[model samples]
Target: MSTVFASPSENGQTSGATGGASTSAASTPRRSAVAAVTNRLASPQTINFVDVPAQEYYSTNVFTKSVMKDRLPKSVYKSLVRTIDSGEKLDPEIADIVASAIKDWAMEKGATHYAHIFYPLTGATAEKHDSFLSPTADGSTLSEFSGKQLCQGEPDGSSFPSGGIRVTSQARGYTIWDVTSPAYILENPNGTTLCIPTAFVSWTGEALDKKTPVLRSMQALNKHAQRVLKVFGHTDGAFVASTAGPEQEYFLIDRNFYYARPDLLNAGRTLFGAKPPKGQEFDDHYFGAIPERVLAFMCEAERELFKLGIPVKTRHNEVAPGQFEVAPVFESANVAADHQQQMMLTLRKIAEKYGMACLLHEKPFAGVNGSGKHVNWSLGSSSQGNLLDPGDTPHDNAKFLVFCAAIIRAVYKHQDLMRAVVASAGNDHRLGANEAPPAIISIFLGDQLTDIFEQIKGGGANSSLPSGTLEVGVDVLPPLPKDAGDRNRTSPFAFTGNRFEFRAVGSNQSISGPLVAMNTIIAESVDFCAGRLEDALANDPDSLNSAVQSLLSEIVGECSAIIFNGDGYSEEWHREAAERGLLNLKTTADALPHLASPENTQMFAKYGVLSARELHSRLETYQEQYCMTVDVEANLAVNIARTMIFPAAIRYQNELASTCANLKVVGFEFDTETLDTVTALVKSLQDGIATLEYAIADDSAVAPEDACRHRCDAVLPSMLSLRETVDKLELIIADDIWPLPTYQEMLFIK
Candidate 1:
């Protein structure tokens, strides 16, 4: 056996040597790689299953209402519940009692340190830890947690990405306790820490994080929803809240592969790799049997989440190999957003223990199904459950139509805003691909709902489709009752029974942005409907039902363009959508600018969701993020192609040249076809690398939007060209000499 020398790069590609005769030198890395795979496969994890019942383990570390009631005085507990339930201002006097109870509960859970965790503008969770130990005068330590410390914490804001909100001189920021989101104890093998959920803000009191906007949007939504419900004769004072159930999708690859791939390590994606022959084309991976190793990882991760009060409900194989999904039951939008972040952190942490790395990138692998966080959202109050649910009666159905009409109007008027919320360089690769939803933000009200809306537009919706049953061919199978509507997987926004699933949200993104946009736009539409309905009622008090029907009719007729039940991914639908005057903001560069449009500015300002300054800052930040992401990926492509791939190709070419020369010298004719092909590809690769290098060297300072445009126009195309040549080379290169892990190895080996 010939020894193969492999000099892999940071991203796991052999950069130095291609082929060598010394077996020991070449076999070292090869032996390591093979050993990694063998060890992982043979030594499966053995999780020690705890004997405790699930109900007892659930929410054990959380400071739940039950815990609060048990720890705090009756008066304090009642006061806190009032504030939580009614969304009223918290009473400062009760903070001491609440803080003491929370501290006691956390201490009982074996926590000695506490941290105020906040969601910052970087689309990630941020925290600053503090010890509970306070030194006494005699040098003894006392564990003390004050009310002021529990309510607020000052962290240096200059380090975080504030979008220029905080200057160097003004580096102060505060994390204020969000009572709605419960505090929980984060347990590690070494110790446990009390994690308090909070909202981050700058010194100027501007909204500096995602949670602030989400909370404000929820308030704005509740006000409008309450007004509409009041007009419909519902006088209950319960707070209306938006609910979310985000289905998180991710990929799990062995840690050895992750550490070797520089592109995956730095950019969260593969910059270069030939498409695998056995991709997701056959659709065999979707909902298939879970690999034993992956199931064990999922079980341990779920157990950790359960203790933290995250109600994770479903886990299964996704459409692509190595990809999977986990969904949780619905909760209030604020709490669900927090739990979604926690779930992502937990998955990544637990995967490490299982010797795997969890990938949350939107398109971790090319030519396969990408990941998306389908944010299932709905609005309701304690009094009127699930405002979007259409009950079995005519009156209930009419009420549902009114609320649904509000969503239709919201989507029609603010499709650009919806597209802007999910805009990111990573997500741009997934959206409009065959695997995910199209970039055009259209609402999918299934067959039954579409018919009802059409009838309303004509004049009134007198009836709805009745539920049917499905009968299998075999007599042994039981009949399954059909749902009111069939799901349209291609639509970006689909009405899935009781909730509208925003399918375009990227897996790695925070749910707060999408929830804020959804709530605010729906609030605007609801307010519009309320004003019109009030006017119609004032004109003729006796015809309330007729007035409500007329209002819905007008809304349906105006916003009908956004309601598309057909194939959203089809060319015909694209053309028809354009004919209907809908905007298809395709890329992050194209969609992000819409965030600062005058209409969006006014909407955010009017609803108190975000100020004009904050909105513009966010747009700038995203544009900068997009430009940076593309620039890094482009640079990686050029480096890998020039240093790692080009050398290997040349070495192989040298081997072929020497072989051809020797054959001719020995009086034998040799075909030069292979040599000619390799030469031509090398030349093209050189040309592509030159173009990319030139594109990246233009270091002119410009506006953020202009920078993003340059990246999209020049840098991106050059990167793709370089990748095209390199991937082609990968297909032709010798297997043992190829420096990087093949798609087959990465995607299928596990």
Candidate 2:
């Protein structure tokens, strides 16, 4: 029998990896870290991977429809499918039968326990396992599974951030099964456990987790989308769902290097490092040949993901040296969001087996390209196809334009909310950098769509401009392929061929928050479109085409200011965007507060997505998150400077002075330039450390908003200034004396 162990409890952990406390930096770590890394490179961790075809393990661990059909009574199976299809409440009568099938399948797979997995406000998975074995009649223990247990679970909520919805004394929180997301078994060598996706709520029935709002937003979108289909003479009953293909980017560094860097251990980023001699300047890392070890890790990760039914599609080296990206085929927004979390967890776990650490922080290293989750978002039904897809049929094309306008309007009006959802202290470092989209939010409608909208703005689009080909000078090369428009990599939100790629979502963020905003805002826009057309249809009782044209023209014209096909990174665009009244919120402090804006509160309430109180709570929760994140990073900076960098520099100076004194005694000459430079750097490092320490203690703001501003204005800049001094010292200090791992060692050694 395989070893069996239950899943761990939530215990009310904080968000992501940011925290106030961590292991102290070693007083003399360089020699040990370097020796460890050298030995590791000589005899690296071996991946004894046995390759298997994807089909062999695809969804093998999931209690999917096939399993349901085989084990459930035909009547029960069909009934459950119907409810799940319509997003309706599951029938109480069928719960027992469904739970039995799920339990049987899990038991057959050698699972002795099951966990109710839910995404809490902390932006991470929370689960506590329960054994199947239970006390039964006649004083015997029997393995049992029941409908009640499968449906609901109570976990302590007092420890999690509820944004004031649930006080510390109110400890009761409920996790209810989310039927839309399927159940799968998590395989560990020690044991297997049945994992059910669930939505968490407080005892007072407020959303205490990310999944609930996403589900609610889907319903809101569906209701308005059905009206659009009803007017156009299609199946109004068919459910419309937002789909997402979130491309995750991260860095993989040797575990030896990871263990040596206290800042990386605690802050999820290097607080100090000099730029390596050879960086990604050659543009060679992007699409470069994958290292053999990294390839093995990717293959195993994909294999594990395949078993869980995540259709991972792409893998390649990203623009940064140590950074890489993985993307999956599009799936329902809720499932994709769930799978994204699973993907991150799996990557981290697998990296360990290979003696590495996967860094998901948006900017783990300062001078290199940071990671971002580019979410390709669109709306569709299996029956009607993608509403955003511009089909060949003129009628289909017209509907596509209407839907396109809906997106434009949604983004134009709610750009602040879009920025707010992706706000974090970690992400703040990435945005507005050359590698990422700027802090200002704008839409990139490609040439074809932009042309169409331009025509619409002029009254009507008589015809869509064809995607012309580009001709290469070489006769052997094929002619340029048909494409409506060129890609804009720098835009925060850009409409690709069939979907809008939201490029501003930080690598570490949960896609749920962004998906919720996208769904809700688009739903409101669709409703606005439907309402306007409904008015025209009722009054005229004819000429549907004219009404659509008029509606398209108005939406396109009103929302035209948000459509920027130019470069987002340009200074000219920033000035122009400001002239057009677009917000350029450069920091989390400038962005997150918009969540509680009266208009946003009203919108969330109107769509039944979030109550005013719920929205306020989220604002408070994220505000606290932002504050906590900076506090941790700032503290780490101070500790590393005082404990690690300062000591190393002093030791190097003393060693140098001793050597120079001996050289002079022996009638030899030494360059005083080197000594002078080291001495100056040591003095500067101490001064920088003092400035950072004062910034850390200077906070007097009681309001969350003011606290965030203080961090943004005072703490962050102080940290950066100190980093500048520390990084310069890293260049001058002897490598043998430097306390932490260098970028070259971490980025290229693997």
- Check candidate 1 and list the clashing pairs: 4-26, 7-14, 7-15, 8-13, 8-14, 9-13, 11-260, 11-261, 11-262, 12-260
Q: List model 2 lDDT by residue over 135-238, tens digit each.
A: 87889898888998899999887778999888878889999999889999999999999999999999999999999999999999999999888778886487
> What TM-score goes with each of the models?
0.96, 0.94
lDDT of 1 by residue, 1-750 (tens): 111111223224332222122245444333345445544323433444655656778999899999888888998888888877778888889888888878888888788999999998789888889998899999899989989999999998777777888878899999999999999999988889999999998899987888999999999999988888878888787899999999999999766667667788789999899998899889888899987767878888998999999999999999998999999999999999999999999999888766678999999899898999999999898888998887764334656777888999999999999999999999999999988999999999887888787877787777778778886799999899988778899999999888899999999999999999999999999999888888887888777788788888888778898988888889998899999999999999899999889999999999999999888878877888888889889888888788778988998788889999999999999999888899999999999999999999975758888888888888888888888899999898776667676677777766
Best by lDDT: 2
Residue-level lDDT for 337 in candidate 2: 99
TM-score of 1: 0.96
Worst 10 residues of 2 by lDDT: 1-10
List pairs with backbone clashes in candidate 2: none
Every candidate's lDDT: 0.86, 0.87
What is the Å distance of residue 249 in model 2 from its true position? 0.3
Indicate which candidate wins on TM-score: 1
